[model samples]
Target: MKYQLYFDESNKLDQPNGGYSYYGAYGANASVINDITSNVISIYDSLNTKSEMHFREYKDDKHIKKYFRTLNYVLNQNVNINIFIVNNEDAKNTAVKMNVDLTELRKLFYVKIPERLFYGITRYLQSGTDVEIFVDSSDEYEKLGLYTKLKEQMNAHSAYRNKCYKVHAAIPLDSKISIPLQIIDTLMGIVVFLMEKAYKTASSTSKIKSDLIYRLLIEGTNIQFFQKQITLYKWEGNEEQISEIPVSQYITEFLVYKTQYDLQEMGKFREIMLRNPHLDAKEYRKLIEYPNARLRMLQGYFDEITTGDRNISIR
Candidate 1:
């Protein structure tokens, strides 16, 4: 049996102050998952200081760094882990475009994280193997709008793989099972590392080497993975007009941009734009015309421009 899991974060990838990375990991055999969860929980119980399972909200860069160090230690002891990292860059960009300072951005980011890691889980029974998928649930679960949308996306991916998969949703800190919790812990730890690395690198203070090592630790465990292809469209519009759209969506879209395009692969942006006719350079420049518009444009779109570029400061 094989499993595929999917997770979504509350905010976009590059939130300035407060944003979290959410994860979902699914596996083939429930029995194996049970064992894996038990082992992980035991390790965490040994390492955790609090009597009751309590996690400190990740605050500053220092806190983030320390968390990663400990998480890395825990993961090192446990092998054969599969994880996924999802970020909310759209929320971050919205804040920046709206002139939200770092402090305010942080506040918004922190509040938006889903309470439980396994907010959504699904299971599928097939002929040879059973497939299961977990998703980070949105606050709007009652509406069933977002949940349906996510399931649709997952089903599409499953169809592409030509496999039968099931999906389920779990609440954060729910006590139905311990193994899922352990998996969630391990997955969260890995996401923290990836997010911290990405955040630090963006801030120009990265201290880690070997991004591939981190990817292996986090994403390599999953049997199958799918990500939304993000395309950034820069339109010629006034600040007021751009601000009308929620900042969160903008940041989410940008993170998708950054994940797909980095400094070494900068040329890929042009290629993407060429393929996506709706996002021509002229339209892009026009869409982003506010203060630091260029920087905002590149935050999740292009990879090289920084906060201090002359073009961004022009207006």
Candidate 2:
């Protein structure tokens, strides 16, 4: 069997308080790529816009609706997205504690992005497969010989001794002209944006994003399909420390990591938006007079998340 995996990384390591960003990839059987790409281009054809299909640029109404359709279509396809999130704050703290420079610390795990993501897919299958990798173009990858290293590491990986999975090609392709990269870019955007709590603010763009999240995750039984195709791994401590800590301590640490998502910032945002929901409830009731649908979506979503009706940590 043969498979094709497309890769992208959304790592916000420089942000001191920015909690988590993901590094991962999504792809499918090699034969499926062309068809998927063609289908996505046709989706763009309907919109008649040559604008990029990335996540951060989804501020327009028509474009976002088309984005919703594209998202639904891609999620329903035969593919899997494997992600690993790095907690920036925790990672920096770990670097200091270990007496290693941050750059040196990153070198310890940077290569594992491909190795770990590959294992995530291969272990689920009953048989070994030949694989080719396509990463969004980056000079950094070329300098590091990431593709070559991936080939060597995957072919020799012990877990695949029986399965015999092979890594044939690991090359970078420009996302500007690649639909698969752009599509995955959108997917990456949604995950990163929500994790960063970018949807909590009072803005038209925030509302648009919240609506998309609602449609993709909270509405009906969407998460069932989502959970099936997406595997999210949140990484904080180094691999060595994982064994040193007790299971109870690990669980406690994870719970703290998950809940400690920029709480102080969120508090300030709440105060800026409205300290009391009840006080804003009457205003929201009157906002029907405002006649802007997207803002309403944003306000309602903000209310849902604020009131605990919807959790931001949907993964």
Candidate 3:
């Protein structure tokens, strides 16, 4: 079997860990990847502008619609989304207890987290499958020897080696340039935001995000993975409390996250949009910035996007 895994990490280890740092991969059979991507890309074709799908950049209702459409399509395919989360408080405490500096301890995690995620993700893969890895562009991946270490560790693991699972070294690709990278970016971004509990606040951003997540939980999306696909690690220092949790528990949290706000608003949004597919965006912009004051987003949203250009969201 030939497989491709697009990998992404949410926050840099060099930065002080906030709620947590995320490492995850979106995997699928190499054969179906093109079909999946083409279907997703077509969803964005009707819009006036082209922008990479990114969850962090999602602020308004338009972003919500784009993501809802993408998720509606991608989740039905034969794919797996696996994640490993590190408890920042546990990491910070371990740094102090082990007589190691905080910065030094974090440098180790840049490698350890990816190694763990890869192992967990491979458990469900068929034996003899060869996986090609692609990571989001980051200078630290090269400087810290991440690619070599991952390849060596995977190829040398006794279980995987016996199974004939050949793992390739990762190549860094800019998310802006790779639609595959964009898929994992938005998926991971949603996970990290939920982990950060960003929706706990009363801010407008939080409400919009809640609505998006609510859509994810809709019946057919399959956003909730089976136990075989997702692995959640608490990374506790204590011998007893340290253990990996299942997707069941993670979904338990998601259920709670959705309950923080009433769903009537989201229900109305979906119902109206389904009735008048083209009317939503038109009505949304009526309450807007003055025509003279609004300008192009200071980024490119042209016919062609190039490697050197930053992302543009011209509304």
Candidate 4:
């Protein structure tokens, strides 16, 4: 078996913890990568823009629609999406505990995210499979060392050495033209956005919303894994529970704990959209513009959710 994993990072704005808080990868059989490219191109063809599709540039309803359609297609395919998130607070604590400088600790923790993501991918290989991994190109100096570090780590791991013939070193590719990278970019963006929501609210509702897509994809499947590790300094009001869980145990617990309640909620949202597929954006704009716009905008949301249409009677 041969696999290709395309990875990208999110929130790479030179933060204290080496820019990105999350790194993600989309992995699939090397043979089927072309099909993935074709599907993404098909969506691009429907749009009027000639420029590349980017997560940051997704600002309008049309862009949102394209993102969902493309993402839904990707999730339904034979691919795996794994994200490794760095808990900023956890890193700070770990740095302090180890008597290390925060800046050096941040860089070390940043390296660990990709290493863990790579390990998650390569650990599942059968006796004869080889893997190739690509990450979106970046100018950061740390990225320059990832390839060598990953190769050394894979070779050093006895499980990987025995289960697979060889693992190619991870390489960087320009996301501007790489469809697989773009797909992963979109996913990383969504995952990061969901994480932000989870951090801000600290509620089960937010957690469910964040995991909804992953739960839906993994239902009735036992031959796959969606690896997630979050070492938050705090969780569910427990600040002392900052230890990291083992990866396999974490995956198993995630699969078991997730319920289909969200599915029903998701189905309701689906129904609204399907029923009001023709709702005009202009109508929404009208309700949101001019006189007492704030109050009207609030009412617009209520009306849209209640009636499943943007044509609200603002009486």
TM-score of predicted model 1? Answer: 0.36
CA deviation > 4 Å runs, candidate 1? 2-28, 44-128, 135-139, 166-315
Q: Which regions in candidate 3 have their CA more than 4 angstroms from the true location? A: 124-127, 158-161, 219-229, 240-242, 248-260, 263-315
Per-model TM against the reference? 0.36, 0.71, 0.75, 0.63
Q: Kindly provide the TM-score of model 4 when superposed on the true structure, using C-alpha atoms.
A: 0.63
Best by lDDT: 2
Q: What is the lDDT of residue 195 in candidate 4?
A: 45
Candidate 2 — worst ten consecutive residues by lDDT sum? 242-251
| Per-candidate local distance difference test | 0.37, 0.64, 0.63, 0.54
Over 186-246, each residue of candidate 1 has an lDDT whose tens digit, in order, gives 3444344444445335432221122222222233322122121111111122232221112
Model 4: residue 110 alpha-carbon error in angstroms: 5.6
Q: Write the per-residue lDDT of candidate 3 for residues 67-157, one digit (tens) a residue.
A: 7667656766677777777666777788888888756776676556555676656666777888788877777777777677666666666
| lDDT of predicted model 1 | 0.37
Q: Best to worst by TM-score, what's the order? A: 3, 2, 4, 1
Clashing pairs in 3: none
Candidate 2 lDDT over 1-315, as tens digits, reads 678888777764543345665677887887787778788788878767666788877774445546766777787788888777777777888889989976666656556656676666766544557788888778777765767766677677635466666678787899899888888788877766655657557676765665566555544455666667777776666554222112223223333442343344344445645744554533543443323444434344455557754333221
Candidate with more favorable, higher TM-score: 3 or 4: 3
lDDT of 4: 0.54
